[model samples]
Each structure stands twice: as C-alpha cells, then as structure tokens.
Target: MPAYDQTRARVEDYFDRTATKTWERLTSDAPVSRIRETVRAGRDRMRDLILSRLPDDLRGARILDAGCGPGVATIALAERGATVVAADISPQLIDIAQLRLPHDLQSQVTFHTGDMLDPKLGQFDAVIAMDSLIYYTASDIGAALAALEPRVSGPIVFTVAPRTPALMAMWYAGKAFPRSDRSPVMIPHAHPKLMSAAKSAGVRRMLRPVDRITSGFYISEAMELRP
Candidate 1:
C-alpha cells in the first residue's frame, strides 16, 4: 500500500507542531526560499480573490474563516469591517494568528481552535476556506460543504487541488515517499467529480468553478457556492 494516510488529526498535528513556525514566517513579510515565495504570492492572490466574493463594505457581516492558518484571510475580512470567526484545527496556529493580528482588528476577530463546521460557530453571511480542503477526500469536502450550507446565508468560497498532469505526478510522488514532516498529500480533484460529491452531500447550490492558480509548487482552484 502507498504510504499515503492523511486525516484531520495528522493535518492538525502537522500544522500545530511541525509547520507552525514555517507557516508563520511564510505568511509574514519575512523572506523565504524561492518556491515558498511563489506559494506566498499565490496565497495572497487567492485570499484577495476570496475576499472579493464578499461585500466591499461589510459593516455588519459575520464571516467564518474556516481552517484559517495564521489568520491572514481573517485579518483581511476584519479589515473590511466583518466580524470574523477564525477557526483552525491547530490551537498553536490559532495562537500565532491571534498574535499576528493588528491591535485595532482584535475586536473584530474571534479565534476558535477546533472543527470549522461546529454549529456553535453559529452562522455566517459568508465563508472562505482557502487551501483548507485540498488535503481531504472529495467526500469529506462535500460533507463539509453540506454542513456549512445551511448556516451560511451567502456564499461558501473555497479551494481544491485540481487534478492536472503536474499535480497528479506530485500526488504519486507523495504517496511513494510520504513523511510526517511534509505537508499532507493533496488530493487532486476534477471539477465534475467534486461537483458530484457536493451534490451527493445535499448541497443544492451549484459549485461554480473559478480561476485555477499555478505558481511553482503551489496549485489550487477556487470556487464559490452561493445561496
């Protein structure tokens, strides 16, 4: 069997321990390797794209930054005047995010370290999960969306690892030499297949495919589900 086993626990552990510092640095203005620089740039673009889906003047909006690592998107959402609940699986990462947030925006963000689909997160006008679902199976992604759909009155924006020749090769390589220190293997998904999973999960809203971004080792496709 391929050495490819990824679960929520593993992902959380990796982020909380193995990669917290790296992620913190990468998300910051600090310099990084060339490959990481591309990733940073791509993430920035994706964050901006996700934010664009929300209203320009979010004076009273309540948003969820699902699986928010270091709270970059959470910061942006709060800056737009939205009250953001930044939820992450890793408590350590959430702490880092809390520290990184500007003092003025502190009042706008509430940090939660647990499942993003927690009902106690209350509801949201919109949600964005950038690169958070890329490591999970299609079915899991679908179930997550299903859980979020009822609570969100607006759009549920997210990203996935699109199945492409290059990404497929990377997936295989990951299976061949998986390690705990590395990021979890990203499950590649075809748009049609993902949409089918979403449908199966009772998410009635159509999964609208947006732009696919590729920068060095980073590849993710953004989509939005609106009510």
Candidate 2:
C-alpha cells in the first residue's frame, strides 16, 4: 500500500479502538478532578481558537467539520446555528459523534464516514479540520488541501503538529515508547510545507501556534486558508 494510505489506515484503526477513551481524555483525565479541569480548559482554548477565526455569528453559515471526532467541535458549531456536516474516517468515532447530538439539534448537523479526500463531500461556507492533519506527510497534506480547496467557499481552519527540534524529539519519543494502543505511524509537517501546499492549491494562508503542550515538546498550530 502507499505510505499515505498506510498511515491513514493506522490512524483509523487507532481511533476506532480508542474512540471512547479519547473522548473521555478530552473532557476528563479521571481519578483527578484537577486534571480533568485542566484538560477541559485546554480543549476550550483550542475550540476558541477555531471559533475566533470564524465569523462572530455563524447562524446562517454552512460549515464542514472534517475529521470531526466524537462531535465535540461539530456539536459546538451546530449549537451556534451553523448547518454542519461532520465527517471522519473512523466509523466508531462517527457513530459516537452521532450519538452525542441532542434531538433538537439533530437537524443542524449531518454525519459522514469517509476519508477527507473523498470528492463527493461537496462545498461549504467554511471548513475546519481540527488537529487532524498530523497524520499526513507534506505531500499528503498537499493532496488533502487540494481536495478541500474547491469545497470551501471561505476559510479552511486546521491544526498541525509543528515541525521543530523539540517537537520532533517528542514525536520520536512517543513512537519509541512502548504502548499497546498506539498507532503504527505518526507524522508531523513543517509550517513552510503546509503553506506551500496551500499556495499550490491557490489559497492564501497564515499560521500561528495556538497552544503548547509539554512545555514545547508538542505545539498545536492553527492555519487559516482563504481564497
């Protein structure tokens, strides 16, 4: 199989097996309320970063939440009155996300299970792929952006694992560490590579580190793409 396909398969498998645990980790660390509080606060910061980049009022906007895991951001967007289509490659995660929606808010969101590169996804007023680009290499990132470019009428917001010495060391260490539930592959891309991809896709882009984890070992960056 191709390297990108292999990486994608590993990511799907990893998330499929750990969907529930991952969702729990997002809201709570468990066995410690303080840790849970911290986790929630960090999640809010990331969510706010995405929201701040979007128009202040999204009541009539149509949004696509690419790689929407467990419907966290998807639900948030729907609650803000944006018509949302949430898609993920992992079926388990999509199912969990679907279950998380309230009955009244059901009409505001639709869910799909497939790769982000799938062409039938159609277009949207805006697109957000939170923390999902970490699985792709530079070339794969380019291809994914190419796929998403025409589909977005406005900005495309996504997060990537920044490429820096300290961050790269942490990524390698995570790979070296023994873990029963780890994915087979983990890739990080440099900001320049991502910008080049956006440029090739005929979009203007800007990036900034929105959050730091482990004191620089891992930084979450937010990138905005505009036509």
Candidate 3:
C-alpha cells in the first residue's frame, strides 16, 4: 500500500475504536491528565493560528475541515460565517463531531465520513487539515497535498510534527506502547525537506511555514500551500 493509505488505515481504526472515547473526552470539557491537557491546549492554539491566516470575513467562503476529529474546528469555522465540509476517516468520530455541533450552526456545516482528500467532497475555497497529516511520511504528505491543491482555490492549510527534541522524545516514548494499543506512529519533518518533497510530488504551490505551537507534549507546525 502507499504510505498515505497505510497511515490512513491505521488512523481510521485507532480513532474509531481504540481512542474514540479518549478523544471525545479530551476535546470536551471533561477532565484529563496534565499531559493530555497540554495537548488539548496546544491544539486550540494551532487551530487559532490556522484561522488567523484566513481572512477575517469568511462569509460565502467554502472550507474543507479535513480530519475534523470532534467538530471543534468545524463549529468555529461555521461561527465565522464559512460554510464548512467537515470530513474524517472514522464514522464514529464523525458522528461525535456532528452531535457536538450546535444546532444553530447546523446549516453551516456538513459532515463526511471517509478519506479527507476524497475528490467527491467537491472543490473547496480553502482546506484545513489541522494535525491530521502528522502521521504520514513526508512523501505521503506531499502526495496528499498535491491531490488537494488542484481542487482548492485558496490555501491548503495543514499541520505536521516538527523535528524537535521534545517531539523526538515523545516519538521514542510512544514506541513503548503495545502495538495493538498505540496510535499511528508520528513522522516528523523539517520545512525545507517537506517543501522539496512536496515539489517533487507535483505540488505546484509554495509550502510556507506559518507558526509552531508547543505546549508540553504537543508540538505541531502549521503551513500553507497557496496557489
């Protein structure tokens, strides 16, 4: 299987069955371990950073919130006046995301369960994948971005695990988990290397690094590929 497909399969199973409730709680107001709390906080900051890159007025915009785990980002986008297609690999997570979305914003968001890059989801004005692409190899990520680039008129905003001492330590620590219990392995990349890989894979737009968010165990960098 291609690296993206392989990682997507593992990610689907992990989030759907193994870690569904764990994530539900983490994304919710429910209490969690200090470590996980940091992760949640970091994700909030990353999401905010992603939003900042877009225009302040999103009215009439069409956005794809790829790998929208529990709909937090989807709801936020809807609140900002953008019509959002929230897509994820796990049906279970998609259901949670749907249920978590406020009724008032119901008309602003649509939910899809399947590939985040599915062309059938239709073209989009912008695409935001948040932390969803972190588990793929740089080549796989490049290919994934290349596939979406043609369909998006604006930027394809995404996040990747940055090559850093803390993230490396976490990657090593994650190896201690039993194979059946662990989440997909995270692949870290530097921006320069990632840009080269994306270009080689036929991604025409420039991949520019926006910012990095680090709160305890969570370390993700945001980037955008614009036409």
- TM for every model, in the order presented, reads 0.95, 0.83, 0.97
The candidate with the higher TM-score, 2 or 3, is 3
Q: On residues 63-114, what C-alpha lDDT tens digit does candidate 1 reach at each position? A: 9999899988888888899999999999989988999899999999999999
Best by TM-score: 3
lDDT-wise, the better of 1 and 3 is 3
Which is the better candidate, 1 or 3, if ranked by TM-score?
Answer: 3
> The CA-based lDDT of model 1 is what?
0.88
Residue 53 of model 1 has an lDDT of 84
Candidate 3 Cα misplacement greater than 4 A, ranges: none
Cα error of candidate 1 at position 91, Å: 1.0
Q: Rank the candidates by lDDT, best first.
A: 3, 1, 2
How does candidate 3 score on lDDT? 0.91
Candidate 1's error at 215, in angstroms? 0.9
Write the residue-wise lDDT of candidate 3 on 138-165 in tens digits. Answer: 8899889889998999988899999998
lDDT of each: 0.88, 0.73, 0.91
Model 2 weakest lDDT span, ten residues long: 209-218
Task: Show pairs that collide, candidate 1.
Answer: none
Per-residue error at 21 for model 1, in Å? 0.9
Quickly count the clashes in candidate 3: 0
Local accuracy of candidate 2 as per-residue lDDT tens digits, 75-97: 88988899999998888788778
Question: Which residue segments of model 1 deviate by more than 4 Å?
Answer: 1-6
